[model samples]
Target: MQIQSGFLVFLVFYTLITLVLLHAVYRTSQLIVDEEFHLRQGEHFCRGRFHVWDPKITTFPGLYLISASLLGPFKACSVYALRLTSAIASIVNAYFIFIIRRTVVGKQEDARVLLESISLAILPPLYFFSHLYYTDVLSVTMVLMMIYFSLKEKHNYGALLAFFAIMMRQTNIVWVGYILGWRALDLAMKLCLPNENHQYRLRDLLTTVQTLLGSRFMFVRVIKLIFSSYYGYILNILAFMAFLYWNGSIVVGDKSAHVAAIHLPQIFYFTLFFATFSGSELLTLLPRVLRLVRNRWYITAFGMALFAWIVQQNTIVHPYLLADNRHYTFYVWNRFFGRWWFARYLPVPIYYGIVVSLAFLLFAQHNGRPPLIVSSLVWIVATVASVALQQLIEVRYFILPFLVLRLVQPNVRPSRKLVAFEVAFNLTVNVVTFYIFFTKEFYWSDYREPQRLIW
Candidate 1:
C-alpha cells in the first residue's frame, strides 16, 4: 500500500511537470538564454562531431553526450528533445531524494518522506530549469545519486556517479570529496571504536582521530579499511588532480569569465537564499532560533559584524549579474541590496540568525546520535569550496548544497501545514516565472531576438 501511495504521488507530480514542460516548449520553441549554446552543442554531438568544442562553454560535455544517447533513435536532436533531458533528470532526482531519505532515516514508505522528496524535486529554482536545456537539473541528479549510493555503502557506484557529476560540473568535485570524507569517518567509527558511543561531538571526532593516529597498528588498520572500501573514491580524486595538472585549471573552457576569487559574501547570499526558500521550515523552528539568539547574543553580534565586513569587502556584482535583467537575481540585487549603499548591510543580522539556526538544527542530537557530524563538517567545507571562490551569484550554484543539507539533516521534517506551504510556494514561483517568460517578451537592444525573463 505504501509503495502504491508513493508511486501515485510521484505519478501525479510527474504529470504536472510534463504538462508544464510541454507548455514551455510550445510557447518558447526557439532557444532562450543558455539553451542556444547547450542545444547547439548537443546537436554537434548528435551529428558525430566529437572533436568540436564550444569555447564559451565551461562545463564538460556530459549533458550533451547524455542527450545524444537519448536522441540517437530519433536521429535528430530537437529543442524539445534536448530540453526533455533535464525534465527526465528532475524526475530521477526526485527518486534519488526518496531513496536517500529512506537510506538515512529508515522510513522507506512514509508519506512525509514522499512529500518532502516531491517538494524538493519541484523546488522553484531547480524546477524552473527542468524544461530548459541547462545543466543544473542533470548535474543535481548526478550528485544526489552519488550521495544516495554513498549512503548505501556502495562506494564503487558512488564514485562512478561522482565522476559523472564532475563531468556535469567541475565544481561537483567538492561534493565528491564530501562523500569520500563521510565514508572515511563512517569506516573509522565502525572499525576502530565500534564499542564507543557515537555522540558525534567535536571531542568525539577528535578522540577518534587521536586514537587512530596515536597507534600505528590502528592507523594501518584504518588505512587498509579505506583502501579496501573507498579505493574508488581515491581514484576519482587522483584522476581529478591529474586532470587539473594537465589542464592547469578545473574549468574546461572560457577561463577568462570563470575566474575563481575570494567572494566571502557568496556564503551569506546562500544563507539568505536558504532562509527564503526554506522559510516554512525555519518558521517552524523559530522558537529554537530565538533561544539560540538569546543565549548566544555575543556570538551573534560578532557574527553579524563579521558578515558585515565580508559584505563590505567581498560582495561581487559580476558583469553578467548587472547586465542580465532576465534573471530574478538582477532585480533582487538592484531593488534590495543595491538600492543604496547602506542597504547591503541590512541583511547581516538575518544572515547571522539563519546561520546559527542551521548550525543548531544540523548539530542537534536525534536518537542519541548527532544529526550530522562528519557530514556537516564536510558540507561546510564543500559549500565554501564550491561558492566562496565563485565570482558569480547564480542561484543554481546553491541547489546542490541546499539539497545535500536538506537531505542529510534528519530534523528537517516539515509539518503538514509547512509541507503544504512549501509545495504551494514553489508552484507559485514556477507559475509566475513561466508566465513572465512566455508572455512578457521584450527585445534586447543589441540582439534581434526577443528577450524573456527567467530564474
Candidate 2:
C-alpha cells in the first residue's frame, strides 16, 4: 500500500514536471545561457563528431554521451529532447533519494520517508535546473546513485557511479574520496571492539589506532580489509589522477575563468543557503542554539568571529557575478550582500547559528559513534574541497553537499507540517523563478539576443 501511494505521488509530481518542461521548451525554444554550449556539444556527439571539442566547456562529455545514447533511436536531438535528459534524470534522482532514505532509516519505510524524498527531489535549486539543458541534474543524479549504492554495501557499483559522476564534473572526485573515507571508517568500526556505552569515545579510537599500529600483522589485516572493501574507489581515484595528469588540469576548458582559489566565505554562503531552503526547521533549531550559547558561549562567539573575519577578508565577487544580470545571484549580490559594508557581515550570525545547529544535530544523531562521526567529518572535508576553491558564487554548487548532508542524517525527520511547508516552499519558488524566467526579458548590449532571469 505504501509503495502504491509512493508511486501515485511520483506520478503526480512527474506529470507536473513534464508540463513545466513542455512550457519551458515552448517558450525558450532557442538555447539559453549554458544550454547553448551543452546543446551544441550534445549535437556534436549525436553527429558522431567525437574529435571536435568546444573550448568553452569545462566538464567531460558524460552528459552528452548519456543523452546521445537515449537519443540514438531518433537520430536527432531537439531542444525538448535535450532538456528531457535532465527531466528524466530528476525522476531517477527522486527514486534514488527514496531508496537511500529507506536504507538509512533501516526498517522505517513509512509515508514520511516518501514525503521527504519527494521534498528533496523538488528542492527549488535542484528542481529549477531540471527544466533546462544543464549538467547539474544528471550530475546530481549520478552522485545520489553513488551514495545509494554505497549505503547498500555495494561499493563496486557505487564506485562505478562515482566515476560517472566525475565524468559529469571533475570536482566530483572529492565525493569519491568521501565515500572511500566512509567505507574505511565502516570497516574500522567492524574491526574494533564494540563500545560498551554505545558511543564511540576518544579512548576507543586511540586504542583502535594503537592496535592497528602495534602489530605489523594487524596493520596488514586492516590494509587488506580496506583493499577488499574499497579497491574500486581506489581505482577510481587513480584513474582521476591519471586524467588530471593527462589533461593538465581538473577543468577540460575555460581554465582562466574557472581557476581555483581560497574562497573561505563560500562555506558561510552555503550555511545561509541551507538555512533558507531548510524552511521551518531553521526556526526549530533556535532552542538548541540558545542551549548551545548557554553551554558553549565562548565557542559560539569564536565561530561567529571567525565567520565575520572570513567574510571581511575573503568575499569574492566574480566577474561573471557582476556582469551577468540573467542569474538571480546577480540581483541577490547587488541588492543585499554587495549593497553595503555591513551587509556582508550581517549574515555572519545566521551562518554561525546554522553551523551550530547542524553540529548539534550531527552529534545528537550519531551519539558520537566513530563511523558516523568520521563520515560527517569526511563530508565536511569533501564539501570544502568541492566548493571552497570555486571562484563563482553559484548556488547550484551547494546542491550535492546539501543533499548528502540530508541523506546521511536519516534519523532527523522534520515534522509533517514542516515537510509540507518545505514542499510548498519549493513549489512556490519554482513557480516564481520559472515565471520570471519566461516573462522577464532584458537585452545585453554585447549580445543581440534577449536575456531572461534564471536561477
Candidate 3:
C-alpha cells in the first residue's frame, strides 16, 4: 500500500504538470485538427442516431457511449467542454501507465522503473495526445489497461483490460495477439497462475464442430473467435450466423477497391506487419550470428535490420513516397520528416529518445530476450517503417512497442550512457522538428497570430 501511495503521489504531480501545459494548447486557436472530431461524433450519438453512416463516427460505439452517458447531449457544452472528457480520460490513463510499469518493473516490489517510465511517457509529444480528441488517447488507454490486468502475476485482470481496450478501439486488435499468448501460458500453467477469478467470464464454452462449421469455417471462424475479444465470441458467433458472416466482404456491391484509395496508407501498414512478423524468420538464424559476434550480435542485427528494413520500405523501394505528405511518406511519420517539432511546447526530442531507446533496448539486450525481444524488434522496425507508410506523423503507430514493454522482465533503470543517448537523440530531433514546425509554410503564419485571434 505504501508503494501504491508513492506511485499515486508521483503520478498526480506528473499529471498536474501535464494538465497545465495542455491547457495552454487547448486555449489556443491552433489546436489539433482532429481535436473536435470525436467530440462531434459523441454529439451525434447523443442525438440518438447510429454513427455508422458518417465516415468519422464509423468506429465502434464504445467511445460514443461514454460521451452519451457522461456528458449527455454534446451541444449542452461548448467545444472545449465536450473535449474536456478526452483530456480527463488522458489523465486517468496515466494512472494505469504508472501502475503497469510499477507492476512489471517493480515486480510488485520496487518503484524506480515505474517512476522512470512514467517520466518518459510524460514527455511532450506523448503528453500532447492526452489533450486532443484523437483516438490515440483512447486506444493507448485501453492498451495499457490490458497490459496491467494481464501482467498481474497472480491475477488475470490484465486480460480483461485487454478486452475492454480492444472494444474501445478496433485498431488495438493487434494486442489480441499478446493476450492470446498470455492465455495459452495460463491454460497450460507454463507461467504464473493467478489465485483469483482474475476477472473474466469463467463459464465453460461448449463449442461443437457442427455448430462452428455449419456457417463459419476455416480462419473465418478462427478470426470470429478473435473478434470476440472485442465483441463476445459467443454473441459474435450468433451474430455471424444471423448476418451471414463472410471473410473480407459480404456485400456483392463491393466498394473495397474504392475504400482502398482512401486507405492507401494501410498498404504500408499491412506490409509493415509482413516485414516485422516475417523478420522473425531471421531470428531463427540469430544463433549463427551470435556464435560469431557474441553479445555484439544484438547491436549488429539491430543496425543491419534497421537499415535494410528502412531501405526496403522507403519510396525508392516502393513509390508511395511520391504521393501526399511525400517527404515523410513510407509507413510512419517522424516530426523530423516534415521537420515540425518545436511549434508547440511539446518536446519532440524526448519522444524520439523514447522510441530509439526502446528500439535499442529490445535489440541490444539478449539476456531476457526471447519471444518478447523478438516480437518487440519486429514491432519497432515495422512501425518505424510505418513512418514511411503513413503520411502524417501519427505517434500512435508506436502502440506495439508500448505494449511490448509489458512482457519484458524489468531491467535496472537504463545506464547513463543509454539514457543520455536517448535524451540527446530525442532533444536534437525535437529541436530540429521545432525549428521546422515553427518556420514551415503552416506554422509561421499562425505563430504571429494574436493569442485572441488564436481563440
The best candidate in terms of lDDT = 1
Locate the minimum summed-lDDT window of 10 residues in model 3. Answer: 199-208
TM-score of 2: 0.94
lDDT by residue for model 1 (1-455), tens: 67547656776768576667666655675767877788889888877787888888999999988987888667867777777788788778777877787677666437667667767877888888888889888999899988888887888899899989988988899999998888788678766668866656677778788888889999899989888988888898999999999998988888988888999999998998788778667887788889978898997788788889989888888998888888889999899888899999998888888988788767776445467787888889999999899998899999989999888877555587787688778778878877787788878787777888877
Can you tell me which runs of candidate 3 are displaced by over 4 Å? 1-6, 51-53, 56-58, 73-76, 107-111, 153-160, 185-393, 406-409, 416-455
Candidate 1's displacement at residue 63, Å, is: 0.7
C-alpha RMSD of each candidate structure in angstroms: 1.8, 2.2, 10.4
Model 3 Cα lDDT, one tens digit per residue, 185-215: 2342211123423322212111222333454
Candidate 2 has an lDDT of 0.80
Residue-by-residue lDDT tens digits, candidate 2, 228-324: 8899999999998998899888898889898889999898888878887776556656787788877988997898898898888888889999988
Alpha-carbon deviation at 220 in model 2, angstroms:
1.4
Candidate 2 residue pairs in backbone clash: none
Error of 1 at 395 (Å): 0.3
Best by TM-score: 1
